[model samples]
Target chain A: MKKHPLDDYLRVARMPHIWCPGCGLGLVVNCFLRGLLRSQLNLDKVVIVSGIGCTGRAAGYINLDSFHTTHGRAVPFATGLKVANPELEVVVISGDGDLVAIGGNHLIHAARRNTDLTVLCVNNFVYGMTGGQMGPTTPLTARTTTSRGGSVDRPFNIPHLAAASGAAYVARWTTAHVRRLEKAVTEALLKKGFSLVEIVSPCPTYYGRMNKQVTGLDQMKYFRDNSVIKSGIDPKGVGIEVNGPIVVGKFIDRG
Target chain B: MPEREYLAGEFFLSGDDACAEGAISAGCRFFAGYPITPATEIAERMSERLPEVGGNYIQMEDELGSMAAVLGASWAGTKAMTATSGPGFSLMMENIGLGIMTETPCVVVNIQRGGPSTGLPTLTGQGDMMQARWGSHGPYSIIALSPSSPQELYDLTIRAFNLSEKYRLPVLVMSEAATGHMYEKVVIPPSGEIELLARRKPTVPPEAYLPFAPDTDLVPPMANAGEGYRLHVTGLTHDERGYPAMTVEAQDRLVRRLVDKIERNKADIIALEEDGTGDAEVVICSYGVSARVSQIAVERARGEGIRVGLLRLITVWPFPDDRVRELARQVKAFVVPEINYGQIALEVERCACGLAKVVLVPHMGGRVHAPELILEAVRQAAR
Candidate 1:
């Protein structure tokens, strides 16, 4: 078999990953790998930790010393790895429900302590693993299985929450902007204090089907057309609403 | 910058403080915990001591985070620990289950307080004895130790770490409010004098490494995160390769090994201090502070010309059922005294298996058993 370029970074035997056909997790992972390669981090010294979700499976797929932790616990688990061995670069990759909802306390506390960690939160707007339930990141009025009549609860603006909780670096990007998202990941990896990179990925099977976007391409097109790059904008003003303009950029860089 | 790693002297210390020192002596380099009554002093001591010994101390947001962090640190190739009381211990159950599933080596010190729900934050209770064994929602085995004095707390904390690393599971030091807050002289041995057991590291190269594959001892050698092994660990049921195998065969294989590792090694794991059980008419089975109280009762019963003996359980979880059964045949009745209402007594009754009568001297909590009450029970059992 011909070796793929990213083969060195992935667990080839664990291929045919469980992600759905048009899911944006693969693209986000690709961006992450490129960014990791571009950052020149010693692959041997990097560890990935993930909570329970579709994105959490990334830990098993990655070739690093990865840990698939319990639900909503990736941040604290990664925090442990980082604090115990400060020389190792620990990264937490989890989803919206796993991060901002059940794991909100740990996320805020890690940011408050400015614990050196990079958190990659894949915002898919619904709980894809549990059959499209309404999550903390679901845009208001967006339909999900739990929100068949449309959600009325306010969604958490992740970047704003991180910045308010004392994260030294915070950024938001959609899967459509792979190059920029990859750049953000590289920068977040290199940041000294707590850093957050929110990847707005498409969940075609759950979030997409429940809403009008039936395929990942539809969601990507919407992102491409609607995203407004507003670098240096206050994160509080970057909330996503139903059918609203998607604001994307690095909203905070303390360095 | 080279502060003394071991105190190496005699000092009066509370059980909580002694527990912290014991962990430091045992090479526990990472401490993550949340503050709760009785157990807070352990966290306090670690906060001040960990940095001096070049270790990490993190006060996590809650007990769940604290327990998760401890497991993470353990996988990062460091001996880690956490301390909590009843409420915090309840919060830690989820991650404790994770630690058990992953077979991570760490220490969890539960300074038990009175509780069905925040029952008594500042008082002692042995109520969590059953919880220690059966708390985490699955069929699993656990090792737990009870310390009656500050000195035992110091000695047993190191043993807890050793047992955890040896068996590749979380070991629980189940102390209660009485021992935790009691100040007594505790002797600290030299660093070289204290025996320490590190986790067994894999001998094979990364390509041949099976993360969950057991040696003859049924314990897999551990690899740290930064080591080139690239191990994958998960809480889900997994195969020897450390990949999730979601089948009944895999579940049976994994769960059985996890359980059998401790059960088959019970002789090496269980510890008890027996006195006068050879010809006694009545035997007192006790642990923690209750053991200390039962000693007085035993002596008084002896003064009254009754053949009474004391069985002090140092290792509580793998509850010396074999020893209990053997003694039950020779004794008329078994008197079990604990701070809780008949938790360990139920175990004693089950182990006796109708050979002898089991009497439980239950205390509601906040205090140890009255020596007279236990002595009265012993006197009646002898008659």
Candidate 2:
């Protein structure tokens, strides 16, 4: 394991991150840095905004100009940020609950308007930050604290949600698929229009304890074993198997 | 229309139109709003008139969207504003906090109507006087004014822009149905020649420009979006670098700066008008539409040889307390007139404390206070 580079812009006072060992948020953050450093983009010229959740805490940890706005309103706040300063690259990192449920209008509108931004939605299938509530992205039949008797409602296939909202780049990756996720982030950052990459992350304490799934390590292995990387397949058909292959790849690239 | 000149280049216009025309003259590139009674005409005039100036006018989804778009335009370095009545004013609160915490400079005009909730949309009221001060959840300070006539509306709207640019905070013009709807002679503020407050440019190089960094005078030099400055603005409690920090030490310092800048400078921020206070037995305090009626009542009471004075609060947020207390010392009673039951009057009482007996002249709904109604309150207070 090589040492990661550090910068003054990044806050170290709040780290080492509170996420349990084997959590994928660290990978997302590292991949974000790699994507940031990969391009000669002005480090000062980029904004990373987050909402209130596990992923929402990313704003405090990042090494750039960032904001931790009110719940569900980060999209609009980020919208203001991008509109007010169109030159700065704005990226929104939100949990599924933060964006899909509360800040839903902001998500659809930013997509419909095709504002230049990157929306990184970490879908842990449950509200991991809030003690495992039933979220909009919670899978059907999945066990959560709120959905004790095997959940009835279906979860949103977020990549397709982005595609439907007219996003330019839409990709999906699980925590175990860090390399592909990194590439996806790079492409989303480089693209000119609204881009969203939905990362299927693990919630070891909440989601893991409730569901019969193994620990975070075993969960990562399970995701690696289960997800099918297809050159061409429907993203909607991916997760709920017996529904179809849990497809992982670039599902849509209008650019 | 060609620029009309009066005492020079000033032409007579209504308070509502004066505001709309002031906005156009200020190089305002965008106006987005919903039409509520009393304040609707400001939006109406802007819609018909903004296009002539090659600007944009949009009837937004709601007051929230109207406020949002105004913020959007400000980020583009375009001067922008919106107009609404009381209910719509309530709807705009959450985003107003957004504007403050983000420190986006723009104007928000609330043509105050009677209300706890939707009391009187067509009538005059200063009920939201305190709401404008404490409406948003966190700590903040605001600049709000109550214009008595069309001329003041025109002059004060320009002042709103200047104050907003100088302090980098949202400034609100609190007009009411009486002023916004009534016709009066007004000379529009000169635009092409008058000093326009241009958007502040980044002083530090683009890389070093912290969007919320305070330099001197407590205001950070701002950068517009296209000028190559990368800014990340948020409504959260942030440090000097505009990065969010939730620590007690950080929050205390941040909140103090937000409150102190306005509190320490209230003398400069506050403005008011006093009429006939020399050796008067009763002093009347009022604002917005009620002040107009109070003006006539004060004169009528004086014509009857009653020793009466009037204090018209132009800047309502800071509440002309110092002037009122000074008047309270010589006067036996302080009278307050408002379309609301007693909103600004309560503020007057707070300021007056026990300096003098306080009198209230209250009106609500679409009803306007006549000289007789307020004069009666004046006569009773004098006794």
Candidate 3:
């Protein structure tokens, strides 16, 4: 039986993963795998850790030494792996809710330590795994299962948070920008300390249905039409808005 | 790799310092911990010492991070340890359960201080004994040790690491604040004299490796993270392949293996020191700091012509049930003195099974029990 090129890098038996239709996690995972392959890292020495979420399932699907840890705990667990075995490369791929909402303290502290880790955070703008609820990166005025009346809560500007907390590299892209997202992930993987690439993914299943009945195609069209690349922009000023241009680019690369 | 010395000659070290040295002797090369009272000295000593010996020491953001890191380091193929006090111990409960579920081998040192929440940080208390057994949510079993002196702290910490390696789970060193801060002469034996047990590594190739499959002894072999074993590890109930199996049958098999591993090895795991039990009517049962106090009280009782003996518990968890049950028939009464209100005393009473009168000499935290109070309890129990 012939194997697919990416088959070596995936858990084929665990195929048919528990993700929803129109979810962007699959595309993000594709980008991540391409980046890993391009980086030419020793696959044996690369470890992936994820907390609880749809993105957290990335660890379970990856054919690597992956840890599906408790909610909000992947950073600390990955920090441990890097500190203990400095020879290995550690990556944390989890959602904004798991990383910044409950696990926010760990994310900031790991950044402050300048720990050698590459974090690929998939921001779907809602808590996708636990039903579409308001998350740390949910855009203001976006409706969700929890925020039935448009959300009054201000969401985290993820890039700004990473840069302010001392990340060595920070970048943002949408799943629609697969080539750029993959390239950015490769760059982040090569960086030495606390690298982050935020992939603003779409969740047509919940976030879309709640907010304007936006389907997967509509979200993809929005990404294609509304995204504006602005490398080296002040991350603090690069916040997302409903029906506005999404500023996406490599904002910080201190290497 | 750099060559390093493992043994340091005899020195007057505190219990905490001795513990750090013991970790080094046991090949523990990774220490991740947060600074807390009583146990902070262990982390301080480790920070100064680990780098010199080609190991790493990290001061984590909190106890939760510390525990998580210890598990991570262990999976990365290093003997890892962390030291904390009451508040930090409480914070580590959630991840401790994770460690148990994943069958990660690491050492957690909880130098006991007074607490339900942050009570008497700089003082001694054994109130965490019950919490150590049932602190983490879910049905699971763990190995815990108590040390009465600085010398024992060194010896037992190495044993703690060995037991964790053997059992493929986290082993706890539950020392009191008094023991942690107390200074005594400790002899660091030559590296050859120390017995270090490495985790059983998988001999089978990556294709045939089952991360959670048990052997005859019911412990699965571990494969290091970078050993070409692209294994999946999760906190959710998992099968032998280490993949999540969300069923009652899967839960039963997984939880039973986790618990049965300890229960089947109870005799080998139980460690105690008994004296004068032969032809004695009154036996004084104690552990940790209370054991030292009870010794003094027992000797005083002997001077007063009472038949008193001491059964000091070195391994606290797994309860020494069979031994306690056996002593119940021979001894007339048992006096259990502890720094807590009455934690281990209840265990003694349950094992005594009404054949012997079990008296508790309780001390509310911040201090050890007075010898006279224990002596009085012994006298009353003897009567």
User: In model 1 chain B, which range of ten residues has the least summed lDDT?
Assistant: B1-10
Stretches of model 2 off by over 4 angstroms after superposition: A1-3, A6-22, A36-45, A145-154, A190-192, A229-247, B1-17, B30-80, B118-124, B182-186, B198-216, B220-233
TM-score of chain A of each: 0.99, 0.93, 0.98
Q: DockQ for every model, please.
A: 0.87, 0.27, 0.83
User: What stretches of model 3 exceed 4 Å from their correct place?
Assistant: A1-4, B1-4
lDDT of 2 at B233: 59
Q: lDDT tens string, model 3, B133-246? A: 999999999999999999999999999999999998889999999999999999998778887888899999999999999988889999988888998999989999999889
Q: lDDT tens string, model 1, A1-255?
A: 899899988988888899998899999889999999999999899999999999999899898889999999999999999999998999999999999999999999999999999999999999998888999999999999999999999999999999999999999999999999999999999999999999999998988888889998989998999999998999999999976789999999997
Candidate scoring better on lDDT of 1 and 3: 1
Evaluate model 1: give its TM-score.
Answer: 0.99
lDDT for position A88 in model 3? 92
Which of 1 and 2 is ahead in DockQ? 1
What DockQ does predicted model 2 obtain?
0.27
How would the candidate models be sorted by TM-score, starting from the highest? 1, 3, 2
The local lDDT score (0 to 100) that residue B362 gets in candidate 3 is: 88
In every candidate, what fraction of the native interface contacts is reproduced?
Answer: 0.82, 0.23, 0.77
Instruction: Provide the global lDDT of candidate 2 against the true structure.
Output: 0.77
Give the clash count for model 3: 0
